[model samples]
Target: MEKEHLIDKYVQGTISEDERLVLEKLKLEDPDIQKEIDLLSDLKIVTELEDKTDLKNLLKETEAKLKQGETKVIPLFKKAKFWIAAASIVIVVAIGITSLLNPFSPSLDELYAENFEPYKNVVNPSVRSDEDIDAEKQAFITYENGNYSEALTQFKALYEGTSKSYFLLYQANCFMALSNTKQAIPLLEKHSTEDTPLAIRSKWYLSLAYLKEGNKEKARELLTEVISEGGFKTTAATRLLQKLD
Candidate 1:
């Protein structure tokens, strides 16, 4: 504010040292003010470097050009309604965009931003639907409130939507939570090292699900493959082998 005041004072030829200090502070703090100050400083330097006689000649030439220019004045009646219509359209658009941006007012972005942390583990990453987004929100809501069954239902719906490996793997995790090993097998089997990140993950989870189901032979086979495949999923395979032995 003081920076703006200083600009006014400077423009009106009434600036003082104290006001100049305020302008400097404003220039340092606000990007827009800083740019204006840089431009003003450049003008001051150029004005000091140039000869007064040359500047006066340039001003006279500019004034002569201005005098030679056509002097047509636009009548306000010709475009009065056009301006009124344009202003009305601008006002309507501003209100509409503002409403869209603040549908929940200062909370939607902050709330979603808080919830949308990519670092957080997604229980059903494969689900990609508006309904699924809402269902998962409710599932997470229930999970937070310790309602495991409701969370599981929403999570199951998510698995159904995207037979994507992550969804399948998440479904297996949910099944393990519900203590239903029977449901985990097919889900895990669907994701067996087909080059997708989920393929690697599916292999790891499938081995664990097999072991959890007491089929040590199948678990051993998958665990061995994961270790031999030698890539991003190998560490998980190695860890599982260590635990089984």
Candidate 2:
């Protein structure tokens, strides 16, 4: 039999003595074999524990019966001690299942944390010297130094004074860095619609903003556009889309 078949049989607790000895020898030869066996064993436990719908339905029925004024003679299953034990088991099983599921299938917040990064200041590289430190230069400086709140103020002022659309992009980036997606999304949306070089880049940031806001549908939509546009963030967008799916 194949090595994989032997491992599967071992995990299912159905391996013959000879097959078990073979797997034990394989584990002695390779540490990764033992790790794989452990992972599959854990997954099997989680899969088996996932089927608690019957227990949950029974609890609900007991609750409904109690609510309907059945105070005469409760059955054994409806006893207070039995209800407490069953409810405790359900809670423990649910928590275990959630913990196991998270690694294989990350939550939206985890995915966003893994993927969302503030777009860098490629459009306006900050000058190293302080000789000609104008408002725009100072804004980029604050942004590059990770002072997002101050940078947000500076970028807003620059945008209002000069009516420059690129400043909007920087403002959105600052909001994103500050974990303020609600403020960032509209600015990114406006910049993304413009016919400018930075517009394509804005879509990528907008997708991340949607992700931070827990709007997966909108994030997926924007990421799809980023991929179809075939520019700066295409590869990253494709990977993020796969994770979302």
Candidate 3:
């Protein structure tokens, strides 16, 4: 079977027993292939830290709006029913305007910016080491520092040597950070169905990548899949899908 097809079947848990045997044989003979499998399985621990700081700011803004509205008092001569109706209209209008002006709904770019944080580095030493290191280590250091160009170059070179899924995933993320969604898309899709650690999350990121590429149909399709799969990011996928609608 073709490598891509085999990978998808295996990841989706639909590979036949014979196909599983074939994949197992190939995995045994090729170190790089086995490394790819292992890395994908390992990357499953990835977690996103919500940016609550922004949420806090939003709450503060809402409070300020409410406080400002409270300052207005109707004169005793005003009709009570008219004042009540006017107050209700003002509240409804304020809410509608707030929703319309929400920074979160502005564009896919803003949504991507809100959600596409780099997966924290799990491969390299947390601190600089004293010993001589390989290209992967150097690549991660540059990546951790947000140097996408250098990190991409290094990751590309490392993948040529290791052919690991982690390298491919990180390389794709580098392309994403550099606004090269075309370059990132195929790489992320390659292992999008694999049962590896990053598999489900890869679909989520791939959906974002589709959004970045302005393919809302593709984005919605993948987001739906992510939501149906229902694991680490179903809530996030739901939120994104709602925005797309």
Candidate 4:
């Protein structure tokens, strides 16, 4: 493929399977192109939050600038040929192109610094027969191990019955771990009402699931429920609740 057509097709997303394979290979080989993809991927994650009106406005403003000819295209960070460098200065550019093709692919959120870290010294001490506690525990272990399907199977086993709210909550967590927020929402909604130990926790998870599903009002309602509960507040949950305001 010619250089000009390759770049044009890649941007247009009209690249065929073969061209996409070629594009991926070229992105991995090229440092500069990789950075733009990484930034787009990172931005994509933050876009999931539903109540992000300020962000929406900002993007609209950026687009408006483009309409007004105020937008500047800074390829290679400069129009000057002499300023070109051989290596990418951004660490994300070097390490991120591989993550962009299926940017929504699920993984444990280790990048967030607070996601999925233990809230407290969580010790599962359930003495119930109905709830398959081992299965739930192993599900998270499998989640941490990156086997989403196996973990989901283990979680579904825990999903039956309502004896253990912890199992119920973590079952919902497994859906989240797999990035199946659509499946997660109803499970979390079932636990979102008061009377169970996990009610507040359910609202927290439900808000995020709503956000992931692009339902801001529902997310806001759930977040409000969490704040109003005045219980089950963890640092990560609290941060999310704060953002709703």
Highest TM-score: give the candidate number: 2
State the lDDT at 163 in candidate 4.
Answer: 59
10 residues in a row with least lDDT, candidate 4:
80-89
Arranged by TM-score with the best first, the candidates are 2, 3, 4, 1
Clashes of each: 0, 0, 3, 0
lDDT of 1 by residue, 113-168 (tens): 22221112454333345464566566555554545566667667776785444555
Q: How many angstroms is residue 141 displaced in model 4 relative to the true structure, after the best TM-score fit?
A: 4.1
Q: After superposition, how far is residue 219 of candidate 2 from its true place, in Å?
A: 1.0
| Pairs that clash in candidate 1 | none
Better of 1 and 3 by lDDT: 3
- lDDT of every model, 2 decimals: 0.54, 0.76, 0.71, 0.56
Choose the strongest candidate by lDDT.
2
What local lDDT does model 3 show for residue 51?
Answer: 38
Local accuracy of candidate 4 as per-residue lDDT tens digits, 1-245: 64334444554456688877876777788755554443333334333434445445545655576587643343543323212221222333333333333456443232222333322214343343645646555556666666767756765666564355555566677677667778877777776654766577777777777777767678677667776767665555666644444
lDDT tens digits, residue span 129-197, model 2? 668888888888889899999999998998899988999898998888888889999999999988899
Local error of candidate 3 at 189, Å?
0.9
Q: Which pairs clash (backbone N, Cα, C closer than 3 Å) in model 4? A: none
- What is residue 214's positional error in candidate 3, in angstroms? 1.5
For all predictions, the C-alpha RMSD in Å is 23.6, 13.9, 27.5, 17.1
C-alpha TM-score for every candidate: 0.39, 0.58, 0.56, 0.42
- The TM-score between candidate 2 and the true structure equals 0.58
By TM-score, the better pick of 3 and 4 is 3
